[model samples]
Target: MESEAGEREPVIIAFCCHYCAFTAADLAGTMRQQYPTNIRIVRLPCTGKVYVNMLLEAFVDGADGVMVAGCEEGSCHFLEGNYRAKKRVNYAKQKIEEVGINPEKLEMYHIGASEGPLFARKAREFTERIRKLMQEENEPENQIQNEK
Candidate 1:
């Protein structure tokens, strides 16, 4: 997972809503909760703005993982934006899987505006998941190299 800095740092691009997830992430920073530095957040007016192509592009452009973080269920500022984002995330996951990438590399999270600790925890958890995924993807090759 750590293949010389910037080679494979397990990066996750998080698309977060301004009212919910983005605010929660800001609170996480304010609270000084330590999470992985690999997360790159892109604040959006709503998670509904997240398109499947944007997600796929992230992977194509080198992101190891992608996350669409939005308001909790029944609490979206835009009424149904979070739900839309969730569906898009799932669809994007399927698309990536079809392209031979693990669907687990993409995730959707529901976080409230005040859930700072949860934001940090999710960030850490996603980073770990990507690390394990990368490790698993490399294991067979590593084994073959050792046998050689």
Candidate 2:
């Protein structure tokens, strides 16, 4: 990942459920919680609405990582929606791994609607994780090993 000036950074995409994670993200902004701006959020009616293809497409479109954020287990407005999303995210992870992509690039998170600071923290943590992963990949030793 890189900035316009080629400075290191990470671009992450977060798919959030309207009933939970999305509201938390909105509240995070109002709460002035400091987080990296590199996380791009896509609000969905339910996390279950996300398809495996969509996750893969985000990667293809240059996202360094992707997150699926939704209601916690047993707390979804739509029964089992979060569970369904978790399953899909896991499946997507396996697909990416099969293609030689790092499975760490995707994650599923459970967030409460009122957890504003938590949302912000997650955004920052994911961005950092991606940044470190990218740094490791770009290291001279890693390049030489990969080229061998």
Candidate 3:
């Protein structure tokens, strides 16, 4: 788990459900929760709103890892938003593999709006995985070309 030395901080992009994960993230902040500083959250009305294109765009934009945060099963704000996100993540995983990116760099998680500790734990866990992946010599290059 080696971080980029000297100056550059690791970059992570999280697409969070506005109803749950996003609010939990906000709560984490208000609670002064200590977690990795690498994560940058992008709020979406629902995980269903997070297109595969957006996930790829994050990788192309230099995110070391990307996570899609949504509500627990059957608890989505839009009824089936998390389900849609789960399906999309699977599709994106396959596409990313085809493009030479390690699919493990992507993750889909469920959180409750009041689960600030859970949110922080997920962030730490995801960040650790990214760190280890970055340190691997045989790491696959999954750099998707940025769209103009």
Global lDDT of each model?
Answer: 0.93, 0.92, 0.88
| Rank list by lDDT | 1, 2, 3
Enumerate residue pairs that collide in model 2: none
Selected candidate, larger lDDT, 1 vs 3? 1
After the best TM-score superposition of candidate 3, give how far the Cα of residue 54 lies from its true spot, in angstroms: 0.9
Clashes of each: 0, 0, 1
Q: After superposition, how far is residue 43 of candidate 2 from its true place, in Å?
A: 0.5
Write model 3 residue lDDT over 31-119, tens digit each, in one string. Answer: 98878989999999999998899999999989989999999899998999899999999999898989777899999999999999899
Instruction: Please state the error at residue 95 of candidate 1 in Å.
Output: 0.3
**By the TM-score metric, which is better: model 1 or model 3?**
1
Question: How does each model score on TM-score?
Answer: 0.91, 0.93, 0.87
Name the TM-score of candidate 3. Answer: 0.87
Q: For candidate 1, lDDT tens digit of each residue in 20-139? A: 999999999999999888999999999989999999999999999998899999999999999999999999999999987899999999999999999999999998999988888779
User: What RMSD, rounded to one decimal, does every model reach?
Assistant: 3.4, 1.8, 4.9
